[model samples]
Target: MNTESPVSRRAALCGIVVALAVPSGLVTACGSPAPSGTGSGSTPKQNGSTPTSASSGGALVALADVPEGGGAVVDGPGGKKIVVARISATEVKAYDATCTHQGSTVAEPSGGTITCQSHGSQFSPADGSVKKGPATTGLRAVAVRVQGDQVVLA
Candidate 1:
């Protein structure tokens, strides 16, 4: 016959307790980052300039996809998320979608600016600057380019 040490039993109990406390959705038994990208391994690229039509690299996104006089949040390169806006026929800009005040996602474009729904903070769509507060700092700008007919936010 064999006896288990008190420490061993205690560790086993602790593990069971932790397993119960963690949320089911937060735990990933596989321990892997989620699979990304189509199996084709092809991704749109930034041409170092903005694309003119409704496509980028080869992934085509319509300018109509963005709201008139506003912006839209889109999946950026490498699975990063970004906010893109069409300020004018010849002007477009992109910025990191996260807010500076408390790391909340910025609100979708409205009334010609992007506002933080979490704290009522406002920012200019053209430059991503704080138009009003609890956010004292401006939004972070990302490089934007046009490739083929798509607007690429790098």
Candidate 2:
């Protein structure tokens, strides 16, 4: 009565192996890099109020100078500039130093947001999203990364 166990155990093991194999294959296919260098989270093509232009390729800034939860604006190349913010110990965000509303430079960060002094436009320093009126478009985010003790614009 209780002697028929070997075949059933083998069948169960095979079924479990098949289940795992199927899901693993699916995950591998789903997790793959794009051919281009840029991966997911590509920059938004739609421009806010400000005209999107080439970044000024400004100087490398020190992370310590940028206060946590605050930011600093610095001039860049070709008269362009950048806004640097330290979101956290490991995260930093950069945006085009120019204000999107009227091409004026965005003022200092205020409570996690950047306000345009020229026209009172506000943008999210976290990711450069438009937060207030007179500027319906979000701030153009510039890629930046930390290398050693200095943060470099990427």
Candidate 3:
């Protein structure tokens, strides 16, 4: 009697889900509107002026917006939802926010780990590797680099 879509949960966080044979690249989403700003209810630290994501392939978020030891889930390249973690002062790491065990979007990194609230799964901020169970696999890596003061798609 309960026939819900498998990716229904994802749609809640993404507003749209593109499941066409599982593309290995950045999956476009509606986490936020493009050509404007970042998502997650937090404003990115601005410098002079903001440029559309097109100018940077995809600007995930401002480097300062992401805490030194924590992370934030934000609108990524092509509007995809991605989790970006600040590893060190100048180093960073990023991954597809979607939980590998299920389709639920993973939580923002905290305490040096990214957690899946849906299934008690945990992943490493260092490499997106699985550190806990319910998920035998690790999160997908989303290529990104710190450009100037922004974390951008690579």
Candidate 4:
């Protein structure tokens, strides 16, 4: 009563294997931390800015490294990605860089907005508020402070 061809059966099995393998690979890649000293250990001088003291919170890029109106993506606590933006000369904000839409790492903030490249979601740097759809929720906030020129967790 079975009429499935051998080739067709093999193709279906391959498809199933691929479907399962791809997702597992993606999940592992997404959770793995960025290489050390490249994400969180970047310095102000390395970022094309003035040098600053290395403080706690893992010494994320210096205060001077973050542009005045734009932001930078750096490694945060536990190797999680974080977006650090300077709203003004004296004001700065920090938020989770993971996109709320689908967990894609968000791009650096520009023009005062954080954008997700995967789904075109946008967020506010001031309060981590959702500025566009596809991402109905805002990014999570991360406590940060300026200490002796370095930006550290508050």
**How many residue pairs clash in all the candidates, one count each?**
10, 0, 0, 0
Candidate 2 vs candidate 3: the lDDT winner is 3
What C-alpha lDDT does candidate 3 achieve relative to the native structure? 0.75
User: Per-residue lDDT of 1-103 in model 2, one digit per residue for the tens?
Assistant: 7886566775666566656764444333434333454333354553332323444443458878788889888765555677888889978877887776679
The predictions' CA RMSDs to the true structure, in order, are: 9.3, 16.9, 13.2, 11.1
Model 1 lDDT on a 0 to 1 scale: 0.66
Pairs clashing within candidate 3: none
Off by over 4 Å in 3: 1-56
- 11-39: candidate 3 lDDT, tens digit per residue: 65454344442542224444434433334
TM-score of 2: 0.62
Question: So what's the TM-score on candidate 1?
Answer: 0.58
Where is model 2 poorest over a 10-residue stretch in terms of lDDT?
Answer: 46-55
lDDT of 4: 0.76
Q: List the residue pairs that clash in candidate 4.
A: none
Among all windows of 10 consecutive residues in model 3, the one with the lowest summed lDDT is 43-52
Residue 27 displacement in candidate 1 (angstroms): 25
lDDT of each: 0.66, 0.71, 0.75, 0.76
